[model samples]
Target: MIRDSYDVIVVGGGPGGAVSAWFAARGGASVLLLEKDRDIGIPVRCAEAIGQGGLQGILEPDPHFIAHEINSLRFIAPDGTRIDIQQTDEVGYMLNRRIFDQELGRKAASAGAQIITHAYVSGLIKNSDSIRGVKVRFPAAEKEIRAKIVIGADGVESRVGRWAGLRTFYAPKDLESCYQVVLGGITVDKNLISLYFGNEVAPGGYAWVFPKGDDIANVGIGVSAAMIDGINAKKHLDQFIERHFPKASILACVSGGVPSAKPFKKIHGSGIMLVGDAAAHASPLTGGGISNAIAAGRLAGEIAAKCIADGSWNEKDLSVYTRMWDKRWGDNQRRLYRLKETVFKLSDDVFNKAAAVLVSIPTEERSIKKIIATTLKNNPKILLELARTFF
Candidate 1:
């Protein structure tokens, strides 16, 4: 029998929802996590890369979900100049999202959170000015589930946020339409992730090749919709693959949109809150969201539990979530967004020059910090912006 009421109802079962449900249940709140898909993390859409030590405080590392460990990065310029940088102190990982998501959902279940997959949330349950719960549709029936608070961990095209009257829409320039393919039978550096930049390659975005193992990698391209110029993301990605890995065999294909804008000013209102992509918490520069989503989900869950315990469900009470997120990541995201805007405006000539400058740097000083410093030496304005963003 499904309970009609819960302390918190979390919509969507990605990293954000799973983490939110786990933390909320762990905090003693009666939680319900709903996933529209029959299986969590199906049809992996991400590039599957995360920074080293990103999930240390959030989720414990599970070998079952780690596909590859990366220790270096290579940036390829428009003119085919490759600049390699090794992570001497920090590393990253390529995750099997299908396994990682299911494991996260399992963790949430273990924490006393009830999960229901294939249950699509069709509408919100409202009481006066505050959100009360959600209307879910099952294969055989449609039902209502009530909650003290509702958390939307839905993706870029989130309806939950819009239903709650939040500005979840992103401008074309602030959205990245991405296309990716898993390629096998190709030779690639198993320990290094590569990024390719140029208008012809990705127009306002970048292309990436993240290794999964020996001879296998997830190759993808993200193109800003505003800069697509009549072409689609797949077209750009196809051109890149043909030019570089012409012999690689395609294994799987995925496409999706990512929000590349700054976070909304408000992620919470009354008894509702938005986390992850719904909140636009992704990194504008790199289009990375997994780590930030997990972090935001955990914080939202903890705060939701507190609200339940204190019997405070008003917007003002929930505003703490927004404040905390801004303090933790908002500034960094804003800085990165500024950098992205500036970098996207650079011409192919500028990119070629930057790559040339980077190649001139000694191998010992080829760190990202030094590369940026050397490349932007000719552009005092951008260099100043970079300094302010980092320092």
Candidate 2:
């Protein structure tokens, strides 16, 4: 039963939206979660890889969504030299987003949120300076859904943030135009995640091969939009596929843009809050967003619900989420954004040399930290920057 209004309205049914709705409902708010897609996680985006510790405070990795457990990863340089890393702890997970996203939506519903698919939110229903609801185009009819707080968890092309007048623009250098394909019927190291780097491979970004099973992998590429003349992530990805998995069958493919930048100066307005990619929370260097999105989503949900309880869903109340995010991931991402500006511009030869340096380390002694220490030992400042970027 749809209601005229709710305590919180979460736009977009990605990880961020699900969690936001979940926490808000748990906090006793009437929550509504809307997904524009016909189904949750149908058109899978991203390479679908997340670090082991990435979900620490979120939720346990459910077997329903675990596609593969990664214990090792390989880095391929421009010259074709490979640097394989054996993680001492749990490395990461290759997610079956179809299942992952569905389960997240299920959790939100289980926590008392109302979930609706194919609900396309066209614009915000604003009341003076603050947002009061949304104008949505449902399959059957148009509707005006209201809420005390509206969370914009919509991805890169977030209309919610723009509608709220938040700064959502990104410089070309900070945007990664990405294209990914799931290749089947090919033999790959199922437990390993591979990264291919070189200008010839991905230009300003890198190509990734994340295994989903014994004979299938998500092969993809991300290139900086500024580094290229146009939106060419798909073209670069096509070339990489032809070279490496020529005989494999592409089961699925997707192309999109990922924004990576310092946390927005303002992610909240009078009655709206933006989380996930809407807030430019993806890693500036790697362009990964799952972990960061989940972290921010939780904060947004909790804070939004708190504001609803206090009867003050204003810009000031929502600013608590900003402060919390800044304390945790704000400084770190800002540092990475700075490093990305400097490192992502390095020449292919420099990347090759760095890869060689990493490969030179004995397998038993190899660690990402040691590799970074060895590669950037020449510059103490860069070394310090690298040391602080990981956590």
Candidate 2 global lDDT? 0.87
Clashes in model 1: which pairs? Answer: none
Lowest lDDT block of 10, candidate 1: 382-391
Colliding residue pairs in candidate 2: none
Question: Residue-wise lDDT of candidate 2 within 69-158, one digit each (tens)?
Answer: 899988898899999989986679988888888888888999999999999999999977889999999998999988889999999889
- Give the per-residue lDDT of model 1 (tens digit) for 184-260: 98988889999999998999999999999989999999999999888899999999899989999999999999888
- How many clashing pairs in candidate 1? 0
**Predicted candidate 1, C-alpha RMSD:** 1.6
lDDT of 1: 0.90
TM-score between candidate 1 and the true structure: 0.97
